[model samples]
Structure formats: C-alpha cells, structure tokens
Target: MLRELRWLMAGALATTLAACSPGDTELLAPRATARAPGRATTQQENLQAFARVYGYVRWFHPTDAASRTDWRALAAIGVAQVRDAATLDELRTRLVELFGPLAPRLDLWIDGESTPAPGPTPQGRDTMVYWQHEGYVGTRLSLYAPPYGQVRVNAEGPHRRRFTQAPAPDARVEVELVPGLHLRLPTVLSPADAEHDGEAPLDDAGLAHAARSASGYHDLDVRQGAVIEVWNVFRHFYPYQDTVEIDWPGLLAQALADAENDRTVDDTAATLWTLVHALQDGHGMVGHREIAARGRLPVRVEMVDGVPTVTGTDDPSHFAIGDVIEAVDGVALAPRVAHLADRLSGSPQWRRFRAASWESLTGPRDAAATVKLRRGRRALEVDAHFNASEPAQPPRPPQLHRFDDGTYYVDLTRAQYEDLEPALPEIAAAPAVVFDMRGYPSNTHKILAHLLREEENADWMHVPQVLAPDGHIVGWDPIGWHVRPAEPHVQGKLTFLIDAEAISYAESILGYVEAHDLGTLVGTPSAGANGDIVRVDTLGGFFVIFTGMKVTRHDGSRFHVEGVQPKVAAAPTLAGLAAGRDEVLEAGLANARTP
Candidate 1:
C-alpha cells in the first residue's frame, strides 16, 4: 500500500541564497581533474546516464520534437547519444551537439510572440551551455570518461565537501550553489498566487514558501540548480526577472473568461495545466475532483478533422465507433469545438506547439446539456450529464478481475479503494499479481498500502522545505520525512503494469519497486512528474501548478517527465482490453508468474 505524504521543507533567504560559507568545505567540488576520463565506464553506462538525464529534460527543456513530437523525439535523441560515447567528456560534447542541433526546432516548442533572430548561443561559445534554474550551468564532470556527462554536481559549489564512501565507476561527485534567487510561485503565500510577478509587493516573508538549500539524494546539495530550472521553464521570462510586477486579479479574470467562454471545464483546465507544466514545477497542476464520483461519459470521443468522433468508452448503449458527435444535450459540436479552439488558441500557454499535451485539449470536456452527435454522418444527440467541477484528485477507480488462470487485473481510482479492498484476498490467491499503476494513485495512500505491506519505515517520505512568500530565502535544516515516510512492502512477488497514464507519484512508486527489486516493471516509460507539486490559487480564483524539484534516482537517473521503462518491453499491438491480447499486461503477468 502507499503512504500519505504531506510534509513541507523549509526555505529561507539565507538558506536559499547560500548553503554554506567558503571557509567550510560545502559539498561542492574543487578545481580541474583530468580533462578526459578515457578509461572510465562502459558504453551502457554512458547511454543509461545520458538517457536518464535526457528523460528529465523531457519535461524541463523548453524545445519541441524534430516533428510534431517536438518534445518527445528531442528527448528520445538522448538514447542514441549515450550509445555512441566512448568516455565521460565525450558524453558532455555529445549532449552539447545534441542540444545545439535543437536550436532551429526551438520555435516548434517555444511560446513567444515572435521567433528570435538566428544567432550563436548567448555566450558566443562553440559549445551550447544549458540554462538550468538559478545560475547553474550544464557542464562536464572530469571524474568520468570523455563526451563528458551532465548532472554530476560535485564540480564546484558554495563550499567543498568530501565523500566518505567510494565513488561508483560512473559516479563523479560535484556540486555548485547557483547565485541569484529563484522566483517562487504565488501559491506559497497566504493569498497564494496573489501577483503575476512571483514577488509582488509582499513585505512579509512569513507568508510564503521560501527557497532553501537542498537536502540532496544522500548528503549532496543541488538545490539551487533545481530552482533555476523551475524559474525559466518554457522561458516565461528570460535573463531572469530583475524586478517583480505580477497582476493577480487581471490574470484570474482572463483565465475565467477564457475558460467559461470555451464551453467545457476540461478545456479550460487543460489550458491552465499547460501553463503550469511550462514552468516544469512538479507541484504545479490543475485537475477536476468530480471525475471519480460523477459518472464518466459512456462515450469516448476524439477530434477528427475538427469534429468529435466516438472512439470507445464503457457505455455500450451510447454508440458505435467512428460516430461523429453532433451536439451534447442540445448543443452543437462543430461550433463548440471551433469556439474552444479559439479560446485555447488565445492562451499563450496552450497554443505554442502541437504534442500530446496539445492533442489532449479536446478530450473529457464537460457537457452542461445533452450532446448532439452525427453518427456515421447521421445527426444524433447524446445527453452527457455534467456539473460544476471541483479540484484535481488521483484517477477514478478501475474495474478488477481475478481469473482462474492465475492472473489478476484491475482498473483502479481513488474512489474504488474500498470496493477493491474486499477483493485483495482473492487477488493474492492468484499465482501471480499483475499490479497496475499506469497512472497516479486514485487514493492518497490507502489501497497501495493494503496490498503491498511486508514492512514500513519512515525513510521513504520527504523532508519538507517550508518557505515564505515574497521570494525571500529562509534558513531551515533537514530531517527525514515526518509523515507516511518510508515503509517498504516485502510481501508477494509482483509484476507492475503501465501505459501513458502512469506518471509522477506513480512513477516514483514504480521506481521504489524497481530499486529494491520488489517486482519487474513492464510497459512504456511513465509521466515523470515526481517533484513537489504545489497547487496554488491565482489572484481571484484561478489555480496553477508546476514541477518543482530536480529529482534523480539515488543512482542518478532522471525522471522529470520522461517515464520509467519496463524491464521487458511489450511490443505494441492492436489488442483492445482483452486479457490474452495486450502484450504489456501479458508480459508483466509472465514476469510475475516466473520463479
């Protein structure tokens, strides 16, 4: 089962501004080592390292794919890169080259009024240096082989600290405390998102969540670079906002008018969610709380040639596939979609590109009245009951089944935790458990904890970094998590399942299982949103969330947006919800059933 986590880390101007004085050896690295590590690690090491970092960049980087997959494909390129490198320094060079090539594709993902002029990088240097949050730079770690790598933070920091344990073959310890300060979102304040500028006329630091020095993976401190990444996501502001001037009420008014005029609450939510995602703060988000209790449309629809076409859903009586939607209750489809497109297009956050995030704009829209549809070109109206939505929660509950063939399956959401609980004993009776966490957990920590408990420890949780509003750094120290903390379940052998829906906290759950050898993962990578997600209200009532931390595995793999990969990858097929049909689930079951 999962633990409910709600601890906040404390941040102060002193802690955020500087972790330690130069007199002490602050966990950072000293000057140059060998320029090249010609005999460091293997090619797999390089590939895995680069691949992991690249995955983290998927959510954090500000560019798009070479095609409409602008973000995905660009992130995928990191795979080929690590496979080709011979040494650590070479890895760094390869990354520079890889990102450099993406300069032209920049506009494909960048959100701005006009494309900037063609020019060399801002530094005028041959090598392209990445702008992480704060003053952090993406550079090489001499400790590894050539084609040097990224994310080895031991190079230089506010102070120098030494390692007590031996370094791994691929490990090059380094750290650097970035200069300047990070811009915390308005959520940390009492009014929460009062100003458009992160620091709008707020004199009291007590009201906000302050940025503080990081309590790293083990003993490392890479906090500043994290804030830097959070600050410039999607290039909301370049060079950094020297001064703060946020328009609270104005932004809220715009968001509401934009959302209500569009017709569907889902559309509006996606627009705001896109903006929060741009910031890349894991904590930033917008979701409806009603999807769990309220019934879902039996009809599944997708936009085809700018029209709503039925895809699939649980409801059998609704309609057949390929049926075009004419209207909802009494509303028409074409006009509504057109208007929605316009409203979404008007928002700078959602319009800058085309991708999964962009493509999802048309789905699960709220229907105030019955919807009308054109099935197979025949006009028909489908009544979809709708209501005013609440806030975001995990996913809705899933259907579960236990086959006499020694297999178990479930489609779970937060609401279904109780119903699912009574069936656990039956599930455990199966020869193998095919645990599916393809997405975020519906419940905060109930169902997960029930099925997977062998032991529980407090170490699994996080140390909150409490902050004040107004962008002032505050000083606070670290301790292990105070809440649902670390408690590992060493019970039954498990095989986890996933798809695109598996993301963020769910990904973290997957990682925990993988790291401890609890089970074998089978599926595609998850939605890597495993940071401290903060949901803050805007000036009036608008709310937004963004990714916050730069979380890497204890071993250094990244998970910003790129998901976790399964141990045995399933070949994609056309099986629709059948047990013997889906390769991903079958593979997971096979792995679970194995000795």
Candidate 2:
C-alpha cells in the first residue's frame, strides 16, 4: 500500500526578506526586443510560441479574469487556435485573441515593430500585488493547500522587489518570447474591477461550462496542449531544478515534436514518460491506469552475482529459483534492461533495480512469450505466461519475528504502528533487534520514539518559496519530522537493512537513524530520492506525480540522488538465493549479534 504524506505547513513567512532597493525594480521590467528570425514555418514552432506566452499569462498575470478562467480548457482551445498559423502576424493575432480576454492587459507584436513604453507607477495605492508560492505544484495543488498566492506588498516596506508590475492595463512593455514573436503581459496591477475592465468575472457556472466546451485528450490539439502544460509546470516549479542536469528548453521542444506525431494515447503517454524520466526523480510517475495494469512475469528477477537471476516464484514448471534469464522474445536481456531503465526516473541503482526486477519482463496483458533461461549447466526454452493480475507471492512472515537466541526482528515494510505497538515490550527487552527496510514501509516511522533517548528533530526537506517566474526560488520553508522519546526505550543493539527499493519516507527514517547514530545500516545504498509527492491532473486525461520539496541530509549535504549509504555493504548472491538464505538480512543479524 502507498502511504501518502498528509502533513501541511500553514503560517506566515518563515524568513524575512531584505528591503528592496529602488534600482532592484529593473528585475521586473521587460527586456528589449531581439532581432527577428523570420515567420514561423512549422506548426511546432507556432505551438512553442503559444506555450511560452500561455505560461507567462497563466502563472504571472494577476488579474481576476485570468485567475477564474479554466486554464486547462484554455490551453486546449489556444493550441487549436494558434497551431496552424503560417506567419508571425497570424500567430500574433491568434495569441492576442486567445489570451486577451483573460488578461486584458496582454499585448503581442512583431519583433521589428516599435516597442511599447512602461506604464506609469500608480500614484495613490502604496500596496503592490504579486505572486508568492510555498510549494507550487500546478493546478492539482489545491487538493492539499493553496501553494500559489497573490501577496500584497507595501511600497515603503522592507521586502524583496524582485518582480516589477505595470501600473495599469495599457502599459505596453514588450519582451521577445521566440524568434519572431514578442509579448507584453504585465505582472502587477491594481485590484481587478470587472465593471472597469468591461468583462464580467467567470463564475463557477461559466468555468464549468468552459471546461465542458473545450477540447480533451481525444483531439491531437489537446494532446499537444497537455505537453505544453506539463512542460511549463516542471520548468517553473520543480524544486530540484538546480540539482538535476536537464536541458529544459531542448526537452520541451522535443516533447512538443513528439506530441505532434502522437497517433494514440499510449504514444502521448510514452512521450510524457520520457519527459519526466529526465528528472531522475523517484516519485515521478505518469498516471495511466491501462499502462499501469500491464502484465508481469510470475518470477521475481534481481541482479544476483552480476546476472539477472530469478529469486522467487511459486510456479516452478516454467523456471525454478536461481535460474538465469538470458533473453526474452529473442532480444538479449541486457539491452532490454537498459532500454527499460532509460524510460524510468530515479537514482542509478533504483532505476537499474526496477528495470531488472519486473519491467524487463513486462508486456501486454495476458500475453505469452518465450524465455531463454539457464538452469545451472543446462539452457532451456520455456513459454512464460504474463499474468495481468499481480503475480502471486510467497506468504508474508509474521510482522514481529523472534529467533531462539533472544534476538527480535521487525519488517518495517510489512509492520504498521498498530501491529508493533503490542510487541514493543518484547522488542525493547531483547538483547538485539533487526529492522528490515528493503522496501516501502507502512506507518512505522513512529517506532523511532522507542529507540531515541530524547527529542529529535530532523529538518531536511525544504519547500521552495517562489516569488518570480522561471523557478526563481526567493526562499525556502523547512519541513521535517520531530520524534520524542517514549517509555520502554529499546536498549538492544539496533540494525537496519536497506536496498535500492527504500525510497522517500523510508529514506527519511534512515536519514534520521544515520544522523543520530541510532542504528547500524547494512546492505546497498538506498534509492536516493526523497520528498513528499505532488500530483497534478492535467487538462489532458492523465496526471503526473513528482517530488514537491527539496530534501537534503541532516547536516545540509546533497541527498537527491545520493541516498543513505550503509556502513556494511551486502547484496544477495546466486548461492544465497539457491540456498534459500536472505543474505542482506543475515548481514544485519550478524551486526545485531555482535557485542
């Protein structure tokens, strides 16, 4: 079962901003127009221009008209409206027509035209309204809390003036968005008055009506719009923008091109998958039910002795334990593994583990394929049936296990707080204890209380506070776990087992243990991705999930792709698997028994 992070931060600013200097207003001013390349020659180029302008107006423009509009529907309608323009002037007219209603102040012109001057600063109102974000995760963010806000700033107060605003709608400050297109969308304005703007605010009824009338994923235009929407969200709000090395603009161009050629929903999904894979984020996933429900081989494969070896299976007729899978469907398993890995997002170990485990053998639902396997000295060809339903697994062991030697073991992956609460006395009294974290854990992190001697606070996750466009993080609000000591402290020697499957909340617990020297870690490095997930449903049919916050080590070292490493490294071997031994767990047990 997947555990969702439910805690949310609600308060005023956590940090103070330095006073803005008069000269700092230049940061908000629009840039001068660049030399025009020529008219847009392709549909991709026109859509690219539309995407840039759409993001600017949707996120930065602060008018009530823009706020209440159904942005997803508008994106689809906008794509259909502007994608066929053959010249720069045509594109400009379409863009203005599409966005001018939502942002009445919006202006667009050809590159060589005369540039518009800045609007005069307001005379009476001392407060300026601008955007402030604590954890901007796109449209789906409202499900948790409001991540975006229109903050009121006093002109004479001590605050960062990173964004400049035009005083009124008539201001014509222009900046070049693409080679041939230039745009002017004011970032600041006076309070929106529907009567003054000559356009009534879109009520809930109108918003719903617009959404019903707009195009959906069935249309190629809407699919392209979805790509643009997703690309802009990551480009501007992803927390790890500085950590991950991604050619964002190039990626957007490629995604747009791929979407243009997409013939089926699956093709669009694959395109989106490739785009998210570049983040290398463990939490990143494309939410498509059909794709997710694809069939899987019955055997559980893992890298053992540097080969893809089957470790677990209830049906031995096809392949027994310790069988090396050399090829599937005539393709070598090595290249297939690499190909599957390339489409996933995560740290190197995590990606490789997933690719080698189940993804390499996955195919269409209820399909049968030939597998070439080596059982010891004999090579055999077998027909492997793909189970559309989840593969049957061995029965789970007791959550709390006890050995004859007075050592206690708990599988955090299987044990919840309720199950372990009754066994705390036995666990605390034992001479040694081992905790297995080889996979995602239930709500078992609270077990930390019994292991700690005092209150411990691990403030490792930082939520970005964005005040400007293009991922400009002005500040960060830290969020983390706070554990307090409880009765019946576990005096026994502690050991933890971990591997690449341990991610997010698992890493969070391990990070605390490593920082406080509370236990001994044994096994391979963890998955290396940690942070609460932020899921966004696009105007398109599907939704995207990704890390919403930035995470670091307790002492402020990089931890995005560098998960917690164990002091004692160990992995399963072919010999161990054939002998039915859990080598990693044995290693942890060995450490627990020492001293």
Candidate 3:
C-alpha cells in the first residue's frame, strides 16, 4: 500500500537582498559543507527550513501583505544567499534581510527586532510566545490535550520553548516576559502527525455505498476530507501548470456538490476524473482500480495510417488482423477520439494513442458493440462482444532475437535483465541493437548501465520539494543521476523503440538515453507521463497515482507532457502488418544500419 505523507514546517520571508550582503549559496548543489551561525545540519535541510518559513508567512500569515509579494522570486533569489550561511544565526540574518522589505506590513517581528538576549526567562498567564492555527492530517488535528499534568515545556526563551517531560496536574511555570508584547502559540501539526484511523477507511463496496447515499455523499466530512487530502499532496503546478487552466479551489467546490448528487460509484468517479482533466496531466488517474477490473475487448488495436486497426485477436468473431475500424456503436471513431482527448493526459500524440486504445478496449461488458470496419477495399459491420475471460498468453517463451545481419532485437517487456546479461558481449560487439520498449520493462537500471558513458554527469532528472503545504508545486529542483556504464560498454549503435505504451520507467530511462545522445529513437512518441508517482486513495476506494516530481531532459526540456520525441518517428502501417513485418523494428534497424 502506498502511504501518504504530511509536511511540518513554518513559512517566512528572506531578508538577504542587499548588494553589501554576501551572495546566496548554491541551493541546487547536492552537498555543501560551509559553516556559519545558526547553520542547519545540511544545505538541503537549510533550504527546506527556509522554504517552510517562506511558505508559512506567504500562505498562512494573518495579513494579505505576504500574498502580494513576489514569493517565487524571493525563494529563487534567497536560495543563492543562504547557500553561504554558515550558522542558523547567519541564515536568520539572511532571512531578516530578505523579509526586510515586508517588515512594515507584517506584525510578526518583536519590537527592536534584534535577536532576543541569548536564552530563557519566566513569565505569567497573560504573556504568550507565538501563535498560529494548528495543522491537521486528513481530519485529525495535531493537538493532544493531555491531562493538565501530562506535559512540560523547556522554556528556551521568553517566546521559545521545547517539550521536556510530562507535567503534573495544574502545573504552573514562569517565563521572562517581553515588556508590552507577547505571542500565543497555536497547536500546529508536527511533521509526524498522521491521519487518524477513526472511521475505518472505506473498501470498494463501502465506497459504492457511500457514493449512492444522499446523506453520506453530502456530508461535510466526506467532501472536505477528499479535497483537503488532495490539496495537501497534489503537485498541481508541474510541467504544464503555467499553460493549463485550472481553478483548483473552484473545482474542489464543484466536486463537493457533484459528490453529493452522485447516485453511483461511476458518477463520483466521473466527477473526480474531471478534477484530473483540469490539469491535463498524463499522470492523472481517478478510478483506475474499478475500471481495470472491468473486462476489455479481446482484440489488440494499433494506430496505423492515423486510423485504429485490429492488430491481433485470439477470439476472432468478425475482427481480424489488419481490419481498420471506422466507427464503434454508431459513433465515428475519429471524432470520438478527438472528443475524448480532453479526458486523457499528455502530448497530442500520447492523447491520440490513449484515446484510440481506450476505444479499442471499451464497450458494454457481456453486450455486443457494433464495429464498422474497412478491411482493404471492403467495408463491413460486425457485432463484437467483449471478452469476459482473461487475455491469452503466447506459448513460446520470451527470447532475444539475433538477426543474420548481426543486429539484436529485444522486447524489454517480455525479456528480463538476466536474459540480456549473457548476450552483453555480443550485443556490445554487434553493429547495432534494438531495444523494443513498446511495453513495460521489468528492469531498467542494469541495462541502462551498458549504454551510459562512465562517470558522466548529465542533467537527467528533477524532483519537487515542498517548502509549504499548499497542495501545489512550489519548486522543481534539478537533481543528478550520474552514469557509470559497466565494463566493456557497448560501442555499437543503440536504438530504442517506443510508443504510447512506453510509460513511467520506460520514459524515464529514455530520458538518459536521449540526453546523452546514446541511441536513435524510432517509433511513435511515448505516453509522456514520466516521473516518480505517489499513490493516493480518495474518499471512496478509488485509487489515483500522480507524478510526484517534475522530470526534464538535460536541456531542461520537460518530459512530463511532451514525451521524449523520436529522432526518427514512425508508426506501424496496416499494409506492413498484413505482410508480417515489424515496421517500427525495421525502421530502427534501418536507421542503425545507415551511416
């Protein structure tokens, strides 16, 4: 089961903006060892801390002043200044400088604002230190109002303290009071705070029950729980956030209303699906579990000559390989595909592929679908019944194909790492090799090692870090994936064959290949959904896995929406399939064999 996470941190403004002040440090560096006052254990930790402060103030501050500021620019610029911070005090100084401009607008600073005299003092009930609304996980607040005597505080300062030990009933303590000023600290949710297991999580059946219940669906807790969870974790602004139009708050409100009115799980799923479509994210999924269990059409179809054609089928009624589908259930295939594009995520090519694929596999289960087909020059209509049974598998075992021309072909989906290990020497010595990535790969790293140049540092990936919990991408930080190819690195041309099915790990591995100029990419573009995914369970048992990071090529070009484009793009044609040819493979082979 995939677990959800909660972030605990405060937000603040940066103050290190003066020309006289030293420049910001390199926040993007993997490691930094500089030392100064108030130093965080690591530079990354310091950035995280800084981000928390920035976010807390920018988003949660009582006043709207922080909202008006250029926070994005503040973070971008402040990261550079803080890189040189040797101590926490030094980091604080930078923060003061960064926030200096907004100081007047914010009432957060203690008068004279200088660092408080080092250490503790006692005060009475009227005086408070700091206050903010407490945080919550799912629906559970972080606050635990234990028996009065159950907790104690280590007063670090008049306004700063730490939990020490359990206190006795009616325990009274004193702290030095700042004259004329004080702050109340609200119970804020800690990073370790978890969603309470109060109401048992709904199972699939329970989910269906909830969806159909007028009272349960309209219940505030149910609707808010779903919205809050998504708001806390969804990386809404990655890759295409700037281009995609999404009014997140508005959608949440609409979803709540829709959920209340929904009469079935499918209706609720459709509402949730709309929320995903708003972002145009390839990683978007809402009700996959229930949908996947619904049986699909027995035949496999491919987009050929811009038309969906039957490629293979075990239970052939009227459908046969090379039969071009013109329409389904009275709807024109092309127009239906175009209309469904909004519901699918990724680039135009990926959208087309998914839409066509969905149409090929979709229909009323146990009922017949009328498919209009054009087999060569003849047009025919047939009632095709979806296969309720599991799809059949090939009897012959998976193996690598070694051609007479000395080129090797391997379908990564069917082949394993061990299957390729024994042939590494010959594969390296061959004139060219083709890696068919038209399906999911069981492994990638080990095979990738054979293609990468040893000790090469390329801009291969990016991961988003949460500075605050606003349910949106705050920053996309570039990270490194250094390559060190195994002994006897392949000297021959490497060709990667990809299509709509090549996704996630497939697209990720392709990033390194394309970035380093390691091979030729032949075949249609990929699914364009490549990133580490974080799985989320909605109000009902519906599961959604979204891209948790922003991935890009070395050139900083995004791979999330615009998948790695093929150097030589080609699609399988019906004529080629009819003649028993793998056109995609042939294209790759031809490209490799050429000068």
The candidate that wins on TM-score is 2
- TM-scores of the candidates in the order shown: 0.41, 0.84, 0.62
Q: Which parts of model 3 have CA positions greater than 4 angstroms off?
A: 1-232, 235-245, 253-261, 329-332, 363-370, 388-399, 471-481
Residue-pair clashes per candidate? 110, 1, 50
* Candidate 3 lDDT score at position 415: 83
Model 2 poorest ten-residue lDDT run = 1-10
User: Residue by residue across 180-199, what tens digits does model 1's lDDT show?
Assistant: 11011111111111111211
Candidate 3: tens digits of C-alpha lDDT, residues 129-222: 2212111112221364311110112212232222211112111111111111111111121111111112211233443344333333343334
Best by lDDT: 2
Alpha-carbon local distance difference test for all models: 0.37, 0.71, 0.52
Once fitted onto the true fold, the runs of candidate 1 whose alpha carbons sit more than 4 angstroms away are 1-275, 281-283, 286-315, 320-400, 410-429, 442-493, 547-551, 554-556, 570-587, 590-595
Which regions of candidate 2 deviate over 4 angstroms?
Answer: 1-41, 120-127, 137-175, 193-218, 314-317, 388-397
Global local distance difference test of model 2: 0.71
